[model samples]
Each structure stands twice: as C-alpha cells, then as structure tokens.
Target chain A: MSYVVGVDAGGTSTRALAVAPDGVVLGTGRSGGANPNSNPPEKAAGHVETAIREALGALEPASANACVIGMAGTAKLTDPQVAALFSAVWERLGLTGVRIVTDPEVAFASATPAPDGTVLVAGTGSIAARIRGRRMVSTAGGYGWLLGDEGSAFWLGREAVRRALDELSGTGRLGELTRSVLAAADVDAADRSLAWRRLITVVNGEAPVRLARFAPLVSAAEDAAPILDRAARLLAELAFAARDPGESTPLVLVGSVLAGPVGARVREKLDGLDVRSSTDGVLGAVRLAGIEAFGEDFATVPGDLPRVP
Target chain B: MSYVVGVDAGGTSTRALAVAPDGVVLGTGRSGGANPNSNPPEKAAGHVETAIREALGALEPASANACVIGMAGTAKLTDPQVAALFSAVWERLGLTGVRIVTDPEVAFASATPAPDGTVLVAGTGSIAARIRGRRMVSTAGGYGWLLGDEGSAFWLGREAVRRALDELSGTGRLGELTRSVLAAADVDAADRSLAWRRLITVVNGEAPVRLARFAPLVSAAEDAAPILDRAARLLAELAFAARDPGESTPLVLVGSVLAGPVGARVREKLDGLDVRSSTDGVLGAVRLAGIEAFGEDFATVPGDLPRVP
Candidate 1:
C-alpha cells in the first residue's frame, strides 16, 4: 500500500499524480497556473499541494509515502526567502519527504535513468542542459521571459510576432506562412499599414508569453506550411548544442514544444539526430527523489514510467 | 551676398550656420535644446529660429534664397496638425523655400554626393541608410529611443548597464570594461547587485533616451583601452550591415558616435571602406538640398561651399 506523489508545476498548469513503487500512475489531477514568478511561493506550493491531494483523493483512502515536485521556476525557489515560504507550506500540507528541483532535471530523469545525457527543453521558456559525471551545466535561462530565455517557446512566439509585424509594415520580406499568420492575427493590408506600429507594440509586449501557451497550436498552424520555420531552426540549434561530440548519448526533447507540429518541424530541422519525447516531469521527479533518497538502488525500478499527462 | 542656411536641431543644442553662395564662411549661432519631442514644437522651433536669426544678423544685410533643416524628428511631423504648427513657425521667421528632412539624410548628402552611397549614423540613436537613385531606404529606426532604435548609442549604454547587473548577479561574463563602467555610473560591487534591478527598471523606464546622449562619452571611456575590445565585435556588425553587398558606393560616418574612440573602432572595423568624418550636419543638409534643388549641376561647384560655423 506504500505510495508516492509527484508534481509538475508549470507556467500555465499544475499537474500531479499518485504512483506506486512499481511506477503505476494510480490517480492524476491538474490545477491552474502555478509558476512562482506569477504566483507567490506559498501560492505555488499550495497549488502543488492541492493537485496532489486531489490526485490522492481519487484513490479511495489512498496514502503516499513521499512527494517530489518538478517546478519551472526552481531558480527562484533557490532564494532563501522563497524556500522558507515553501517550507512552511510543505509542513502545513502534512507532506514529510518532499524535494523540489528544476523541471529540466525531472525531464532529464524521466527521459532516461543515465545521468550522462542532454535535455533540450522548450516549453514556455527554453533551456538546454547536459549532465556529465554528476555535473549539471546549462546555457541561457537567466530569469525567464524578461531577460534571456532564447530558443524557448516564448522566444519563438515573440520572434513570430516580430516577423509578422515586419511583414505587415513591408519592412521585412513576407514568407507564405508569415503573411497568412498576420492575416490570422487580424492584420490586413489596409489596416495593417495603418495599425502596424500600435499592433506590433501590443503584440510584442503581451502576445509572446500568451501565445507560448499555444505552442501546440503554433505547431499545428505550421504543418504543411512554413510558418514556424524560424522556430524550427532555433529548436535545431538547441538540439545541436545539446548533442555530445563523438558520443551517441540520448538527446531528450521535453515540454509542449515537442508535442505536436513544432516537434515534427524540429525533427525535420534536426535531420539525422535521435530524439524522443520525455516520459513525464513528475515521474522524472519521483525517480530523481528516489535516487537521492535511496541511492543506486532506485535505478533498479522494475516497471516503465507513465507518459506526460 | 546670397546666403543659404542649414540648421541642425538636436536634443541638447540648436546650431545654425549662414553660408554664402560661393561656400564662404559666414556666421554661426547656437541655442539650447530644441528637440520637438522634449519641447513643444513652437518652443523648439523658436529656439532654432532665434539661433538662425542671430547667425544671419551677424552677416551683412542680404537676402537668402533658401534654407534647409536637417532635423532629428522631421519624420515625426507626419501628423498634419504637428506639421502645420511647425510650418507656422517657419513662416513667422520669414524663412522661405525651406525643406525639412530626417537628419540622417543631411549627413548622407553632406558625406558624399555620389548619386549612390550609404550612411551609417550612430548618434544618440542608430540608423543606416542606403541612398540609390532617388530613394532612401533605412533599417531600424521607428521612433527615437521609445520604440525600436537598436544598435545605437542608447542601445549600447543600456546594454552596458544590463551587463553590469548580470555580472553582479553572477549571471553574466563581462570583461574589465563592464566593472569600470558600472563603477563610473556610481554602481559598485557591494550595492551593485541590489542596485542593478532598480537601476535597470529606472533606465528602461526613464533614462534610456537621456543616457543615449552620453553615448559618445561611453564610447570614449571604452576606447581608452579596457572597453574597446568588448564592443569591437558589435561595432563591426553595424559597419558590415551598413556596407552590405549592393552598397559598394561611398560610405559616410555621421553623428557624435564618430567623434571619439567608437569612431576609431568603427573605422578599424570598416578597414578598407571609404569612411569620412562629418562634423557639421547643416553643411551636409545644405549640400543635399543643393543637389536636390539643382541636380547634376550641383556637383560641378568647386570648393565653394560655405564653411561650417
């Protein structure tokens, strides 16, 4: 009857699942936005707690021995203030063995048990990480949307909007996809030129982060077309950067960016690279916590983990 | 004596020079800040008009045929209302046959009269213009510092601040120049990290446009060693973009950006390119207006252009 809980607190949604020692997802639950930057640390932890409670509630009289949460803004959590706030929340939730780490770590763990691979993550934000001999190295993810965060879903979304505006203003040569995308964004020839500046300002200021949530839609929009070509190119860059020199280590593709058309485009752009979808962040977190709590024995797990929910 | 006037109205100073038909030295006048964006159109124009009158007053009583103003924000005069307001100021000054155009055009015109040439202007802001036939095509200059004016003095200044903040936060890898520059800005190691975010917010919110005026100082400071190497690559990019293929024509460097070390770096970056110094905008404007007014015949004039007062 021993059980465990795992949480993936993403920018737009929080997901939790109850799991048995054998890796079976006993029950699952979801909640609204849970990013620490958007929601306070206490609120973010509460969201994870609520999600876990709901998932465990689905399992009648269910119980969990330990819990681990893979969070998008773990950098913020490293701050003592945020950690203190979350610590209180964890204690209040009656959760005993809980560990929180970056979502990318979970993604890497879920993708494979080996600690020598690379993870290319492009959800709302993008970051590339590689693990070599127990050392974790990362490139470009300073503070998310505001500063650097290049090659992320937000970056692609922002670039798409910028290119669209350039096309509308005749400042940039329009590709087939860009023209239609601008049209879809409600910008036309007559009004496009007149409303160009204002619309561009508004789109550049707001739409990037929001449109990132629709990474799947953008991917779908690009299918059989050339809309997200630039995004695909960026994804290729991230993948190339993640590749190990002269080594055939797995290149794991994680997040919604790899869920649909964008992923297909990324694969096409990647050409001969081998990449696969992440199993699930929560599952990865569970495995990671297990490894930390139980050492090498955690690698002896017998069953396959569940796919991302 | 028939005299033509060229006025360069900047954010900090309003300069006016009266030139004779034979390009002889006449008289010059200066006034305070006359940027229309900062001061009311009439007030800004009044400052320039007063300066022009005073400069002309120093000359013997003679009728001037035409006057040309190479102004920074003329394109912003797109609004009929604003244009009309400025037009009245021009009429009241009894300045007839006046032509107003973007300041960069004047710099390009003054820099070279070779029907096809390019101008890379990096003053308070940055703009690259390619003049071919009768058309002038520009890259990246929407509206001063408010909108998009990348690769300009303001951009560099702002980047310097951001890099300093990044260095303090242990997130950036800036060289010797960054630390010195931040120290000069009164931001040091102890208060550097804490002051960074607030300073950036202040710079982003209010100081960008003003700090842009000090780009020359920043370039000068960087040029004296330590910082020159830091921005050499970026300056090279700007030079290359300005002298891209299909732009084999004569190239000119204009604005305060060309005054100090940045200019030297620019020249080094543009090594073999034909780059010349243009200290006077009014002369450039008048030279351009002369060409436009008289076409091919204008180039035949022998070393008779008016001196920049």
Candidate 2:
C-alpha cells in the first residue's frame, strides 16, 4: 500500500493526487492558489500542506513513498526564506525527500511519453523548453510578459490593441478588430480619437500582465489572422530553437493558448513534428513521482488521475 | 505688460515660464510632477496651478494673452474626469484659454523653431512624432514600455537583463554584462543555475517599468556595442517611418538617451539630415504660445524663450 503523492501548484489553484505502486487511485485534494510569486509564502505553503494532507487520506503518512510538487514561478522559491517555507511544508507532510520542479516539466510529461522533447507553453505568459530525461535542460524564451513571451497570449492581446490604436491614429483601415477591441474595452465613443485614447487608459489602468485577457478577442477578429500567423510562427520558432534539427521527438503544447485556435495554427506551422496536448498537469506530477519511485519503466503508470479536474 | 505663459508639466517636475511678446523673460516657477497618468489628477492639477500661479508673480494673470501647457502622458487626460480636473486648475489660474499639447510637440518646437519637423524622444520611454504647425501630426512609435518603446531606456535596460538571462540559460556567453547584471541584482550565487533563478526572482519582484534603471548599466558594460547598434538602427527606422523620403525637415532629438553616446551613434546612422537637440521643452511651449498669440510675423519673435530652464 505504498503510495506516491503528486501536486500541481499554479497561480489560480493547487491540486494533488495520491496513487499506489500498482496505480490504484488512493486520494485527491485541491486548494487555493499556491504560487508564492502571486501569493504570500506563508499562505501558499500552508495551502500546499493542506492539499497534501487531504490527499493522504486514511493512509499512514509514512506510506507516501515519494512525492513531487510542480509549481509555476518556481524560480521565486530560489530565495532562502521562500525555499524554507516550502521545505517546512514538506517536513510537515512527513516526506523526507520531495522533488520540486517548474510546471513546464510536468506539463511536458503529461502530454507525451518521451524522456526528451520540446514543450511550448502559451497561457497568460509563454515559454519553450528542451527536456532531457524528464527535466528541462534548456529553454528558448521564458523572459516573462515584459521582456519576451512574444507569441504568448499577452503578445497577441497587445497586438490586437496595437492594431486598433494604429487604425484610430489614421495609419490603417478600421474594421471588425477595431470594433471588437473597443467593445471589449467597454469604451463607448463616437469619435475614433477618443476611443483610441480611452483604450490606452483602460489597458494601462490595470496590471500590465492582465493584457492577456484581450487575447481571446483577437481570435474573434478577421484581421487577427496576421497576428495568429506571427504567433504560430514565433511559437514554432521557439520550439525549434530548443531541439536539434535531426532529432525527432515529441513536441508538447501546454496551456490555453496552445490548446485553442492559436494551437491549431501552431500545429499547422509544426506540421512534421510529433505533437500532443497536455491533458492534466496533476496526472503528469503523478507519473513523474511514479518514475522517481519505481524507475523509468514504471513511470508509465496506469491512469490514476481519471477524475482529477 | 502682455505676456504668454508656457508650462512644461512632466513626471518629475513641472516648470513654468512667462515670456513677453518682445521675447523678454517675465517670471519663472517650478513644482512637483504633474503627469496625470503617474500622479493623482487632483494633485497633478494642483501642481500645474501652483507652477503657473507662482510664475505669474507680480504680473496680471489676465495679461497672459496666450498660455500653453505641455505635458507627457496626455492620453491619460482623455478621460472626462481627468480632463475636468485640469479644467478646474485653469479656472483657478484665471486663464482664459490654455492649450494642452503632448511633450513631443513642445520638444520639437524647442529644438529648431520648425513649424513642421520630426521629433524623436528616448528617455524612460521612446516615441517618434511628425510635428505639423507645432502639433503632433503623426507618430511612428510610442506604445509605452509594456508594448513598444523600442529603443527607450526601458528597452535598453530590458535588453541588458535579457542578455544576462540568456547567458545564464546557455544561449549566450557570460561577459561583463552578465557580471554587471548579476551584481546590480545583488544576486551573489556562484552557480549559474542558481544565479539565473535569482535574477528572474529579482526582476519579477518590482514593477516591470522600473527595469529602465538597469539601462544605464548596459552602457557601462563593455559588450554593449550590439545593443547600442541595434538601438540606433531601430530609432532611425522609427524616425524614417514617420515621414516620406526626400522630405528634409529638421529631425529633433530629445531625452537623455538621444543626448548620450546612443545619440552620437544615431547621428552617425543618419547622414545628411537636419538634426538638432531640444535644450528644454519649456522653450518649445513658449515658442508655440508665441506663434498662437502673435501672427506669423510675431511668430518669428526673436528669442521667444531666453532664460527658460
């Protein structure tokens, strides 16, 4: 009855799963966001422990033979104090040696059965990584929303607004994109100049990273085809940048942007690549734990996360 | 004596100058930042009024025949509430009519006394504008720090940090820039991976716009030649984008970036072009006021702004 614990700590939520050595689903749990970059260390760590505790239901704590926690913004934990906070959580869970990694690694594992591959993620932010033996050995672009993330959701959303701004400033022809952008911004203005200025005000009024919200509106606009084209090309370029040309391996697409119309466009651009979509990151965490506990062959455990939401 | 009041309301400080039709300096005053986008609207307007009222010392407020207030982030005032806030300040100053223009317009006029020319500004942010009749007729780029501002201080700084991150991530080589970036971030990790993670944490800790602080360090780096080269090329491209070929208007360079080595490089890139540096934007505002109140002949008012700082 030795069980392995797996956790996915994201910006919005935290989820955990426990699976026996033979892949019997033991338990599951979820809690509020546990990303220390977005949440306080004390609170984030507290939630991680809460989720793990709940997932260890009924079984003796020592029965958890191995554990893995995958978190977005894992770089934030590089600080000694933040690292201490999470390590304390591990001690409380009675786990002696727990593995922690960035969410991209787990996402890559969930999508395909490969020890080495390329992973392209495009959500509120975007990044691409080259995974070797289930670990990210190198990355192409993960400079966050400010420096890079060129083809991420934020880039596409900013492009949509840029096109509208250009049209409003008399550089380009106004069309459905302009209307959709204005409508999305809830700016009612008869004059194009006012609308243009209003859009800037609205966008700047919030956190700059939240610009990703407008990304969906781009898919609804006709002229957004150009943006989609650039996104797919940039995303594919990033994925290609991570892998050696002659080496053929699985290419994993993760997050909402890479799972939607943007993903389809990226798929077309990456025609010959072996591609797959990540179904659930928690499942990936479970599989990773399986590997760490029972070696590579056992890493492909029977589905133990069928009901994980 | 009849006079025109010119105000340069910036993010750090607001300066006001009163110039007589005969081009003699009447009075001058200064106050804190009044950029409504960065400051509270009420406080910004109060600063504007304070700067103007103090500049009107011992002079009849009504004697100001024309008044012009140049401010950055003018797009923020497009909001009715923000506009009304400034209008109240005008009423408090007892000004009959106040012309409000973007900072680039005033910067253009300050440099060469051209009624129509090209203005390039690259300080904390960057933008290129085509000035027509002392007004911004068209702009090539000014999309702010998040979306655009290609060669601004923020862009340069982000490039420096990006270069360091790339080096740490294996795509680039460690050099003077890497050491400078790491030292500036106060990350003392010996291992490259730990240093890379720490650098990302340091950057994501603060407001992204503040990355401009690191821009100056890039200039201090030995291998910043490529960044400088790319900056000059991109800036020239933007200025070129704002106008048609063969039309030789005065190309105005403003802001700290354009006044430094970066500017010298940019000048080298643009051979055979009429170029000038804007000493102070308040001079431009004064010239603009002189043009509005005094017809074209008086618009040639010799030394419209002599002592403006």
Candidate 3:
C-alpha cells in the first residue's frame, strides 16, 4: 500500500502525481502557478501544498515514503526566507525528507531512464541543463529574454519582427513572413513606413516575453527557413555545451518551441545522439520519486499513466 | 544684422548656435536635454527656447532669416499637441519658418555638405538613416534596446555578459572578457556555479539599457575582438542598408560608441567610401541654417568655429 508523491511546480501551474510501489498512478492533482519568482512566496508554497494534498486525497499522507518536487525557479529557494516558506508547506502536509530539484532534472528523467544526460527546454525562454545522477549539475543560456535565451520562442518571435522590419525598410515586395508579422502586430500595411514604426511600437508596448505569440507564424512561413535553421543550430549548440566531449548521453528536449518544426530541426542537427522529447514533466517527477522509494530499478517499471494532454 | 540659428535638441543636452550670414560665430548657448520622448513636452520645449534665446543674445529674433532644430525624437512631434509645444517655442522667439529635422540628418550635414548620404549613430542605442536633401528620408535598426539596436553600446555590453555566462557554464578557463564582465557585475567568481547565477540576477535587477556600462570593457579586452568585429560588421551593414547600390555619398558616423575602437573598426570596414566622423551636431545645424538663409553657397563659407570640445 506504500506510495510516493511527485510534483512539477511550474511558472503557470503545478501538477502532482501519486504512484504506488508497483508503478500505478494512484491519483493526480493540479493547482495554480508555484514559481516563487513569478508568484508571492507564500502563495507559491501554498499552491504546492494544495496540489500535494489533492494528489494524496484518499491515500494516507504518512504512508507516502518519498516525495520529490521539481520546480522551475529552483534558485529562488536559495533565499532563507523563501526556503522557509516551502519548508512550512512540507511540514503542514506532514511530510518529512522531501526532496526538491530543478524542473529540467525531472524533465530529463521523464524522457529517459538514463541517470545522466542533457535537458534543453525552450518555452517562452530557453535553458540547457547538464544532469548528473538525475540532478542538474550546471546550466547554459538561462539568462532570460533580456540577456540571452537565444534559440528560444522569444528569440524566434523577435527575429520574425526584425526580419519584417528589414523588409519594410527595403523596396522589395513583402514576403509571407513579413506580411504575417505585420498582421499579428495589428499594423496597417498600406503605409509601409508608418507600418514599420507601428510594428515596433506594438511589440514594445507589451511585456517582452509576449513576443512568443508570434513564434508559430515563423514555423508556418516558408521564407523564414533561415530563422528556423539558425534557431535549430543555436539550440543544438546549447545542448552540446551542456555535454562533455565524446560523452553520449540521452538529450531530453522539452517545452513548446521544441515540440514543432524547430524541434525536428534540432533533432536533425543533434543526429546520432539519443534525443528524446518530454511531454509530461510531472511523470518525470513520478519516476524520480519511485526511484527514491523503491530504488533505481523502479525507474524502469512500466506505468499506465498517460502523458498529460 | 541678419543671422541664422541652429539647435541640436538631444536626449542629454541641447546646444544652439547663432551664425551670422557671413558664417561668423555670433553667439552660442547650451541648456538641458530637450528630447520630447525622454523629457516632459513643456520642459523639452522650454529647453529648446532657452537655448535659442541665449544664442540670439542682443540680436533681434525677427532678423533671424532661418532656424533649424535637429531633434533626437522628431517622430514625437507627429502628435499635434507635441508639435504645438514646439510651435509655441518658435512663436515666442519670433522664429518664423523654422525647420525641424531628425538628429541623423544634422549629423550627416555636420560631417559633409552632401545632400544625400547615410548617417550611422551608435551610442546607447543604434540607428542608420538615409539622408536626402539634408533630411532623413528612411531609417534602419532603430527598434530600440528590446527589439533591435544591433551593434549599439547596449548590445556590446549585453554580449559581454553573455560570453561571461557561457564561460562560467563550461569547464574552460575564463577569458579576460569574462573576468571583466563578472567584475563589472560585481560578482565574485570564487564559485563559478554561484557566480553564473548571481551575474544573471544582477543584470535582470537593473534597467536593461544599463548593460551599456560594460561596453567599454569590450573595447578594452583583447579577448573581445570577435565581439568588436561583429559589432563593426553589424554597424557597417546598417550603414550599407541605408544606401542605394553603388551610391557614393558620404557616410557620417556619430555618437560615443563610434568614437572608440568600434568606431575605428567601422571606419576600416567602410573603406573606399567617404566615411566621416561627426563631433558636433550643432555645427551641422549651423551648416543647415546657413544653407537655408544664405543659399547653398553659405555651406562653403569659411569660419573660425572649432569643433566642440
């Protein structure tokens, strides 16, 4: 009857899973965002606690032998005050010896049984993590939208706008990508000069990360092949940087940007390597919790839990 | 008694010059920043008026045949209210028929008498403008810090930080550029892992454009040659984009970034073209005003005015 609990605390939402010793998913729970950097510390901790409580609905909390929480802003917990908030959550849930790890580590675990590998996540932002023994040892390009995050959705969207502006500045006929970019920014194109200025104003008017909204347009526009190719190359370089020379371990690609054409290109660029895509990070957390409770071999156990849709 | 007035209304400060029809320096004035985009409309207008009034000295404002104001944010005057603010300044000074032009136009005029050419300005932000008949007809890469501004001081500084983070993530020796960047961020590199995280934190905590503070380090560090070379290439391309194919007009380079190593590299790249440096935009304003009042021949008038120190 013993079980383990796993949680994926992300910027937008939190998900938790309870798995029996034999690998059956006993329960699942969901809650609001729990990333402390984006949410109030107390609220973020409360969300984690709420999700964990729901996942343990009918099960006895004390019977859960191991618990693992994978978090997006794991560095935020380095602050004593923030750490104390999360610790209080664990205490309220009557849980002791709970482990906390970076979201990328759990994502890598979700993709492969390998204990060491590289995980590259390219959502609104991008980062590549070097995982050792199922934990993140180091990371590359997590500098966010302002500094780095090259090859990310933000990068792709920004490139799209830049290309559009270049076309606007020229006398040539506008291409599909440029046309779509202007349309998305709600700019009227009858006046090319005014449109150029308007597009910049519209993009800068919103939060910078919102530029990711235009990423899908780049994938759909055939003329944006260079952008796609460059994105793939930058992403591959990021993944390669997180790995050692000649060390071949599974590379797990996660997040929305990697789930499309960019991901296919990244796979082609990362050819000859064991590349896997992680769809459900909470499942990775479940696997890590299983490993902690039932030993390393538990990672290989088959489970009927489907990927989160 | 007839004289012409010229003003450079910039983001940091305003300068005005009253030049006699004979090209003699009659009077000069300086005041606070007058860029409407960065300063209150009333304040910006008041500064421009103050500078122009001082430059007039004991001369009758009605005797001023022509006045030209080169402004950093000329687009701001597109709004009727903002335009009225500037109009009131001209009206109060009895300055009839004053012309307002973009700062790049004046920069080009300051460097050469050419009516059509390219002007590249790369200070905290970067932009290249196509000058036609002593006016800015088109522009490129003026999307500001968020969307573009490639090869700007902000870009160089951001690239320096990115390189430092990349070296910190790898197992390689830290380069001089990396060391300088880390030091600039006030991050102690005793622990590479912690330093990597701290550098990102420090950068994200401040205004993004503040990254320009590290730009000088890029010029000083020999290891940052690639950054310098890329910056030069980007800036040169920007200038080229603002020109017609095989057009041989003067290309004027202006701003603080162009006054250093990056500027030297840019000049080298723009070889075979008439590349000139613009030190005092107010002088250019004076040249334009002279042209407007005393016919184009006045642009060739010999005078004892020295470049602003």
lDDT of 2 by residue, A1-309 (tens): 787888999888899999887887889999989999899989999989988888988878777778889998787787899999988888877887799888989988887667899889988888899999999988888888877888888998899888887777664557888778888889865787667767887998988778888899888777788998998899988888888977689999998888778899999988887999887888888888888887776666734358676
Chain B, candidate 1: TM-score = 0.78
Residue range A1-309, candidate 1, lDDT tens digits: 766777888877888877776667778888876778778777786787778778777453324566778887665776888888878766766667687767777787776777776777777776676655323564423334543455567765655555555555455556554555555556664555555555554464553367454334455454324546666676667656555565567677886667766677887766565566787676676676556544656644512765545
State the local distance difference test value for candidate 1: 0.63
lDDT of each: 0.63, 0.84, 0.90
Please report the candidate that would top TM-score against the real structure: 3
Candidate 3 collision pairs: none
RMSD of 1: 5.9
Chain A TM-scores, one per candidate? 0.77, 0.96, 0.96
Instruction: Indicate whether candidate 2 or candidate 3 has the larger TM-score.
Output: 3
Question: Per-residue lDDT for B237-290 in model 1, tens only?
Answer: 654554556456777777665566767777786777777766567666566545
Which residue pairs in model 2 clash with each other?
none
> Each candidate: fraction of true contacts kept?
0.00, 0.36, 0.88
Pairwise lDDT winner, candidates 1 and 3: 3
Pairs clashing within candidate 1:
B23-B304, B23-B305, B23-B306
Q: Rank the candidates by lDDT, best first.
A: 3, 2, 1
Which lDDT value does model 1 have at B101? 66
Candidate ranking (TM-score, best to worst): 3, 2, 1
Q: What's the DockQ for every one of the candidates?
A: 0.17, 0.43, 0.84
